[model samples]
Target: MESPRVEMISNSFVKPKFISKEAKKPVYLSPWDLAMMSTHYIQKGLLYALPKNQDFSITAFLDDLKDSLSATLTHFHPLAARLSTVKQQNPPSFSVFIDPNNSPGARFIHSSVNLTVADILTPTDVPLVVQSFFDHHKAISHEGHELSLLSVQVTELVDGIFIGCSVNHMVADGSSFWHFFNSWSEVFRSNTISRPPVIKRWVPPGSDPIITLPFTREDQFIERPSPSCLRVRNFHFSSDSLVKLKAKANSECNTTKISTLQSLTALVWRCMTRARRLLPDQETSCRMAADNRKRLSPPLPETYFGTSLHSVKATATTGQLLDQSVGWAAWRLHQAVVNHDDKVIREFVNSWLKRPFVYTMSRYFDASCVHIGGSPRFDMYGNKFRLGKGLAVLSGYANKFDGKVTVYPGREGGGSIDLEICMLSKNMEAFESDMEFMSVVNEEDNKLRIF
Candidate 1:
């Protein structure tokens, strides 16, 4: 299929409306922050439906977004600054920081596409053109020096608009990403940020606060992974379906119950493994990101602005995952999430300080490994730029490879969730055909249509 064309309307930078005295100082990139140096930008799109009223002006709406975006950047100073790395003596270390004084601000692009809202939402799978809506879709976080760390593209559709944001992963994690998004929307509608971001960086005790990266360039850091023929599609899990799965998992397990997320994760993991047709003894694993904000001793503020993430993997043989009940798989996932506390986080940090090991996403350890990014916990539908209260459809671009699944809160809310799963064409076909998997997922919620 031919890719859709994206016509350039206009492109410009959106500088902060107000600069703080602190904006002059460089913000250090914590060891945790630099850990994401090799990953791709977090690209997401919030599709909004246009009201039938003729009074709404696209020109004024675009200006409003830029105005609010500019205001939002004042509180999120790092997004306005460039990531700068200092060259040091041979073979020792290098430091990175946000060059605050030279703020050029976030990149904003006003573009138009020949597609309607239905052209995107009605498809069974996300269109290739959707990738073009986001800037830096193929660029890594480490490349923020020459580019804007935050890029927003306002794409005009025949009957809708897509607010696509590409955020540098090295600068912030999923929590911070959504924090900035909600804050931006908050500023748009009300011109104020209710909860200000805590921009202070944190480091492990008895360790150098100024953590230097092990390498200078990305190639020196790690080799890039080759692009794969991956098919990304969404599977919506309704509240009712999730209740059944959770109840089933709970009935099969102990006094404690598994979370809705864990139950959903187990279903995807097991189904994907079966779809892959791996050997019974072949090892399969699921790696999930654990937020360490509340786990720390003097816990970082809930609004901490940098990456505070650690990967927790649950591994098992294909036979173990398949032969066992769905509850069994969920229990394994629950155990992994529960066990990743502050102690484990600290140990991981100390080990990194001793010898930095950037968990390269390119490395696929098990026979089949799945990495779950984003979280259902985020207020996906709450990002109301006042265009509407609910999302017509929410999706993302970039960093997608085989076995990558991003979890988003469903528009219906009330515990419903959406999983954007990526897999190779054949595997996805098998997965789609899987009776066990499809039988549980709500048929009505599976399509990428307007909520």
Candidate 2:
């Protein structure tokens, strides 16, 4: 062991410096983080529930998770590690910095996690512990930054377990989150870091000149709301069954416009419509997140660790929505993809310079106004790679959040999609029927798992 005299000398003379060569500088978040920024209260408290298998263990799971996150954390360059501070909360919020260390860019934030659900074996009260964790995390703030991204909570319930992660809105986006999760898992499975996450020059070229303003100059920063109610639900599916559903949707639409994702979106939209009994004339928006990394001139690297694309808001009337078959809805959904549109791209750029957070338009579609969520993602690559679950959440300002569903191909010549819907207890039945229909359509052809 080192002597206390030497330790004191080292402490007096040596200042710890962040080894960014091996680690990333903290990335800060800006008010203009996402393409479709929801108002604060509209998109904050999201929960996802996943069914637990008897074999899953909380201790082993957390150990693996910590190992994976800690390993991948080293890949970020100093600039990427820059954290952001926004002073609009009870405790100022902390965001992952989004601007390139050397260049001007919009600040975006999205975070990720790997969680497991195991049966509660001990008689201890888990919710109490969970509440404590929440309070502790909530109170923990990043030093000098207005946003904090390190809040994590774990709770053991009588039936299963829960993991809660609070992410600032200005650091990364959904696609970035996916890339991060995959990288974390890759390192965990291999027991070593994989290739560094790709972060090519993502900003498109030749924009009209505009002055760079501090975040305070922006019009709409997401305002934090008073504490509110939050809920979670979990679901799963096999890989093969989803393809069949997509095929059926394609046939019904009589066009190749239907993708597995679009078909599932149609199913989700229909169920949400039926459950809410929304009128056809009522304006409803199902904002589908489109990744724009490849749409730029110098396509952003898939592993680039910041918000890259603007969210495309697809608005449809309840009547027009209900009148369409799964195929038609899928086509409408496809037409909504506008990553290549120059006008939209310009707006995205301008959003960063203007106020009221350009992405805040999504607030108009909050739970009270429109349904502002989308279906899960399930691709063949997700399965062969064992990328854990492809769950997504749509939350920001409010106490409520939406779930993520993924489609996978099954071994028995079918495709399946797993859905985890979290809403009020009153809406549980509607959610079940939606899942049931999706399962029936896909499972009829093969095996399906709904967890």
Candidate 3:
């Protein structure tokens, strides 16, 4: 299939409308923050269907969005800051901090595409469709000197507009990114801001001094993953199919009731492993990102704008995953989540403080591992953007790294899920034809017509 053509209209830098007096001061990065410094930027986007008869100037819309984004940064100051290290004489160690003065502000681009909303609504090459709407180079750039932690691109189409946002993973996680996004949209809609984030960094209890790991300057920036022939595809399961999956998963284990996420993760892990046809004794694992906000003692603030995530892994031999029932695999996944209590969260923090630079679960990037991203409960569809016509669809984009799967709420508004699966091209072909996989999924739900 031929790729759609997109024409760039303008590229410019957007600074904060109002800079805080404390903007020059440094903000410390927690242990959790350090872990994500080398990860790829988190990219999110939305398609808004404009009223057919309602004529509006695209230039006006772009100006309003840029102004509103600048206003939003006044509250999210760290996002408008550059990452740097602080050398302390007393400890003889350097700590990472966000330097506001050095930040040049977020990148903003205006572009136009010939593709209409209808062209992208179906199950086409999603990554290719969404890639043109985003600033792909800046999204994955590892050059720290750029100092632009956030970038936004507004692509105008004949029938609608696509708002694509990219944020440095080191500065924020999914929760934090959405928090900023919602706030910006609120500003754009009502000309007022919502709840400002709790900027105070959450530190682990106890007076033990922070051990600064020895990391070179290059380690501070993320190294782009090696290129590969990976393809990304989208699959949707209806609410009814999810219910049947849950029932099947629950019947395997009398003690635990598996949630939709666990069941789906188990199913996908099994299918991917089968499609890859790993050796019988090869070790396979599924890694998931768990939110530690409510699980922690006293709980972090709901608006804490930083990385409050922990990586949880469930491992089983390839043979076990392939031979076992979906329910059994789900039980294993459930156990992994249940074990990540307050103690585990604390232990993870402690471990990171000791050896802050070493990547956690780096082995999971191998072919035998599947990394689960996004959550069913994130309310992704709720982002209305106050555009009057409502949001047509919401999507996420990431580097097409193998073994990566992202889950989002189905557009049908029922208790369903949309899986964005990425793997080697050959593996994707095999996965598409897997009968067990096809039987569980609602094939009719594959095509989505948002209009």
Q: By TM-score, who's the top model here?
A: 1
**What is the full ranking by lDDT, best candidate first?**
1, 3, 2
What does candidate 2's lDDT look like per residue over 333-377, in tens digits? 777773346566656665654532334333433652323232344
lDDT of each: 0.83, 0.43, 0.76
Ranking by TM-score: 1, 3, 2
Per-residue lDDT tens digits of candidate 3, residues 203-285? 78773433364555564434556637878777888888888888889988875469988998999999999999899899999
**lDDT score for candidate 3 against the true structure:** 0.76
Q: Residue-wise lDDT of candidate 1 within 1-451, one digit each (tens)?
A: 6756988799999888988888778888777888777778889878888767789998998899999999999999899889987877777668878787665789999998888887887788888898888898688877888889999998988888889899988788989999999999999999999989998788876767677766655566764555577887888778899888888887889635699888888988999999999999988999888899998877999999999998789999999999998899999999999899888888888888887756566554333998888888887678888788645545556777788888888778888888888898889999988887898877776663543
TM-score of each: 0.96, 0.62, 0.91
**lDDT over C-alpha atoms for residue 393 of model 2:** 24
Give Cα distance to truth, residue 304, candidate 1, Å: 0.4
Candidate 1 has its poorest 10 consecutive residues by lDDT at 358-367
Those runs of model 2 whose alpha carbons end farther than 4 Å from true positions after fitting are 1-18, 21-70, 77-148, 151-167, 189-191, 199-201, 204-220, 225-232, 235-241, 338-343, 351-362, 368-399, 402-415, 431-451
Point out where model 3 deviates above 4 Å.
Answer: 1-4, 87-93, 127-129, 136-144, 207-211, 217-222, 358-364, 386-399
Q: Model 2, poorest ten-residue lDDT window?
A: 6-15
Most accurate candidate by lDDT: 1
